[model samples]
Target chain A: MPIKNNNNEIGDSELVDSARHGDTVAFGELIGRHSDKIYNRAFSIMRNREDALDISQEAWIKAWQRLSQFNGRSSFLTWINRITINLCLDCLRRNKRFNAESMDQIDEESGGVERQLPIETPNPTRRLERHELRERIDEALQQISHEHRTVLILHEFEGLEYKEIAEAMECSIGTVMSRLFYARRKMAVLLSGLRQEGY
Target chain B: MIDERKELKIQAYLDGELTIFGRYKVNRLLAHNAEARRLHAELNSIQELLHHNELDHPLPEDKESFRTRITHQLRVEGEGTSRVPNRIRPVLKWVAASAATALIIFAGVYSLMSPENSNQTPAHVLLGGESIEPEAANASFITFKSESAKLSVVWVDTKSSPVASPIN
Candidate 1:
């Protein structure tokens, strides 16, 4: 016997099954549940509101098409998150190609002649009020390169494993660690500068 | 990247992803190196802030439109792909051609097999009270009468000479 949809009150597995069978309502609920998360992931990576919204919608559409392939191995949101990240990565790569020579001047990897130590500056994040601290960090994140910001977001915010980040970013584990370390180093410098400037 | 190995250890330790051996080694190094300790503290503070805070600033308007737009896009895409596939067009044409040919063959066979459709008498029989020599009549013409209508029918044999021969 065919199972009834039960009025949008279904689990991810049921929604996935129905959506696979071409039920738009079931698919719509799934989108409603995870759209914000997917959008934020895109926004963090793209740093642009329009691009984030576009990537979020694109990811959901892709999820619907590949509904049959969802084997319940991971949560629906995680699967969608990976999709959003990949889209953002492709966007960055296209931009990089267009301005290839500009990124050439920046060091691709960490570890140089000096540690690039910050002079004794008070920790701005600690001293600032909570809301101020949050704003400061978001502002600092916007200043870094896409590659560095991505590793930081994946590791520090999304909390993905190094192996997972490597696979998602399509780089070596060492590169994941390297990019992450460089990203943190850059964040530290940026935050320290913010602290000194009292912003 | 101050002391690349140490920086990696700091990240691994902060993320709680280090092996037992790695954790112990980093722990020993952390107690001894001021730079490693400072770096670890800085990274840990950052992680703490991230964990406690979120980067999202979504408007209610944005949230509502996300659902509306995705639903609209899915409906449009669904209608497109569910239509007849181009890949099957050639197969459908072939099937149609085959069906037409079979229909023609069937009508031809049915006409030949039906008694009402017979226009030729047996090769040696006399017809219309004419005493035609068996060989000459067999090679020339034959006639049929529709039993239901009492109608007379005439036919000309094409295998003979071109002169028109009538069946009485």
Candidate 2:
């Protein structure tokens, strides 16, 4: 039977149900609804337009194939974004983006330089507009290592718990905590520095 | 100086990942220690900034185009799943085996054809009665080259029997 309901007028749950029954139009509607969020989530981590585009497409394809497996434990967007994040992580791993050592990894691992730096009491986001703050955050995320950046994105944006992040990142809870702490410290520094630079 | 462990505890507190006792301890620390309070405030500001202001980047391409690409990929991958295992696996395996065998044979032939290090002459040239070194009574060494392989060969023989056909 054809799904007679208007696709845009319907909720994601109804679309999901119809898509699960092999309705390509319903699945395409779900894609149309959530593709930007999925692509943004991928872009937030991958930081490359072409890579983000490929991973987002792959995520949707995988979502279509596994639509039957989506149990609706979470929101449909959340479920699909999880797939996008996983694909991003896998692509990062395949490309060895996470394995490359940098000063961020050294600071994170070897009794951090960030550890010795004093805390800035002034709020980094106090004087800035929301878009400015977001631009600063994106710039800072780009400067950090993939591990630190991934942990921050997972915690701050995805709203994943420490344990959930640990599972997704395939590391210990301690590692997640350490990465999060250092990532926050780095963000504090970057935001403060960017504020000082007036950028 | 706030230790690393204490700092992480403060972060965990800010993130609400701490248990009741941990929260209480962190609260006490924040109340007593000026530095910990500053750290907490800083972390909290950053957290709130991140949580509220994640830059919303819309899909750079049109949604319809992106959706069409994904749909095309799904169709391609769906066909691949049905066609790959039963039909393509044997063909892929055969192609792989043929490639491997060809590589090995080419490597062997190339190595054999390399003659930069060779010093001996061809056997046919030797047999053509070119001026040759006289053989010793007890042993003799004959040096030649292979026509097919373009490699030099050295043969050693004793008075009793031929010890080796090709030594080099």
Cα lDDT tens digits, model 2, B105-130, are 55335434656413322322334433
TM-score of 1: 0.67
- Docking category of candidate 2: acceptable
Model 2 C-alpha lDDT per residue in residues A1-199, reported as the tens digit of each score: 3366677799999888877665667888889888889999999998899999999988988887777678899999999999999999999989876777544386565566888776754434446776876787788789877888889999988899999999998889998999999988888887777556553
Candidate 1 residue-wise lDDT, B6-106, digit = tens:
78888889888899999999999889888788788877766765675656756234555778788788888768663433345457657766654554455
Off by over 4 Å in 1: A1-9, A97-108, A119-129, A193-199, B59-62, B83-168
Interface root mean square deviation per prediction: 4.0, 3.7
The prediction achieving the highest TM-score against the true structure is: 2
RMSD per candidate (Å) reads 14.7, 13.8
Point out the worst 10-residue segment of candidate 1 chain A by lDDT: A97-106
